[model samples]
Target chain A: MSDSEDVLATAAAWRAAGEPVALATVVETWGSSPRPAGSRLAVSATGKLAGSVSGGCIEGAVADAAQQTMRTGSPQLLDFGISDERAWEVGLACGGKLKVFVEKLA
Target chain B: MTPALLAALQAAQAAKRPVALLTRLSDGEQCLWPDAALPGALAEAAEAALRDDAAANLTLDGEAWFVHPHNPPLRLIVVGAVHIAQALVPMAQTTGFAVTVVDPRRAWATADRFPGITLIHEWTDDAMRALAPDARTAVVTLTHDPKLDDPALDIALRSPCFYIGALGSRRTHAKRVARLAEMGHGEAAMARIRAPVGLDIAAVTAPEIALSILAEVVAARRGAALARRAAPAPAAAA
Candidate 1:
């Protein structure tokens, strides 16, 4: 199975175990995004992570957003561009732009 | 994401069925296409994305939605554990195909010979039938022996496998076709077999032959217009 499948399965397993979980998916990409649009990162309440939306560049931010989504029961659309200072601060200096949708698994 | 929806997606993937998950971005409402019976526009969008194995964001009725296509992993079932199989297995794996090598001869299909590979020490026909090659599956028979290769070709021709290749000389392929015909395979079914298999790249070595086969497999999968093989016959010795 591909890594995405493993991520989804991990997310499901965590949810089934009564752990709060959030899924962050790359909804769109521009230029040289490290991962494609469907790539996913599954984050659990206990700080466990499966898969990645980028090449270790912006996952920390996404995971942080995932935790926030889980706590607030709201979804978030995150946009990161190479030109954005916030993107650089998050280490997304990969010369690409990406939109990630983070939603708590209810 | 509802637990039910996530479980359904997992079930579809485990069953190797192609499905698309449609998400309403504005409200976080999600549904699996074909399962929930999407509207015409959404269905069309999902169909297109799934066909390309891509994910896209589209606005249907002025509402932004994400269509994520989930497809089964590609699989390759090789019906011979030969030297060429040795080369092709790793190449196919590198290309994201879960490969299985089948040969009844225990000596040839040993774990030592094919380390870390799925080895099926069964007759070709049985192994092919058990595998049940699907649209995402490719089957290649490398055993030049008719006893091994013919059974695989027969099973593969009847299946929905995306690609079926047989390694042999032109003369050998001709005989194989004749045998398949006598076994009730029609001309159209036989035509599906790319005999003297591989793109005609003038490949001479085993690894080169493996490369050509992998290239042709990718071409077939991507629906690329294949260049017809030039007449020197492939180096897959009969």
Candidate 2:
């Protein structure tokens, strides 16, 4: 299938399989985050997901929150910023904040 | 290896296309091991280990579960056969999105002007099957007519179409929402419809507006690091 069809089908299948899946979206970003506006990540209850919202900096945090949202069916807005205090060598360099609005799919 | 799995891997290795592998990790589904680009975002050794144990990793919106990274191209789908589309289509196409412009107006969607693009002169329903709008793809309705835009948005939101934008004014957007209300879409769903689409940048001409709109779409598409960093910031860091 095409890109659009592929993503929809993948997401639908994940939902239909009873997998608690949450959608991660880049609502707002600060500086030089890896992914872009419509970039999305779908995380399953099993901690499996598709796509990328960042190069990889905030994936771990986003996945953890998405798993929580998927099970609770509660949408959550997750924010991540690269800071020295919370300096994660694996985090983004340009120090931008990414707001990922996660929602569970029933 | 299954043909589908093999093709997906090949696509990634060759940069032909980006495909996601959806495998079931729990017993709810029959997915034993998903041999994805980032099968649980594990290292090659770790992913192989997951495969041995019949487990799978997670990913979405470019975030992987384990720890690996893979970057792919953006996909933009434009709906309409208008002047804005004429500008936006090619502009976005150049920006690396696999652009496909869908319109029932054959006269306007011909290839003479939109040469390399995947132009579809068909109804939205027919084209949507192929155009599967997702978080990676931006769906813009420039038809300016609700009959065309509304139906497309209806299907778009139902699917994982991430960015659903329709061209109109703020007043037009309010009016459009009222009409959509009759269709049973609640405020949340309506909120997803970015009417009066594009950035707040002052863009008047077709080219200028097209650039601004595409810029916003890119802004919405990029990750926090790349999108938020202003020009000077990245330079300073460098």
- Among all candidates shown, the one with the greatest TM-score: 1
Per-candidate Cα lDDT values, in order, are 0.89, 0.63
After best superposition, candidate 2 residue B64: deviation in angstroms?
Answer: 18
Lowest lDDT sum, 10 consecutive residues, model 1 chain B, at B227-236
lDDT (10s digit) by residue, model 2, range B128-160: 766777666788888888877877877777777
How big is the positional error of residue B78 in model 1, measured in Å on the Cα after superposition?
A: 1.7
Report the lDDT tens digits of candidate 1 across residue range B78-154.
Answer: 88899999999988887778889999989899898889999998888999999999888999999899999999889
Q: TM-scores for all candidates?
A: 0.75, 0.51
Q: Which lDDT value does model 1 have at B95?
A: 73
Off by over 4 Å in 1: B81-100, B106-134, B154-160, B164-238
Error of 2 at B108 (Å): 0.7
Chain B, TM-score, each prediction? Answer: 0.81, 0.68
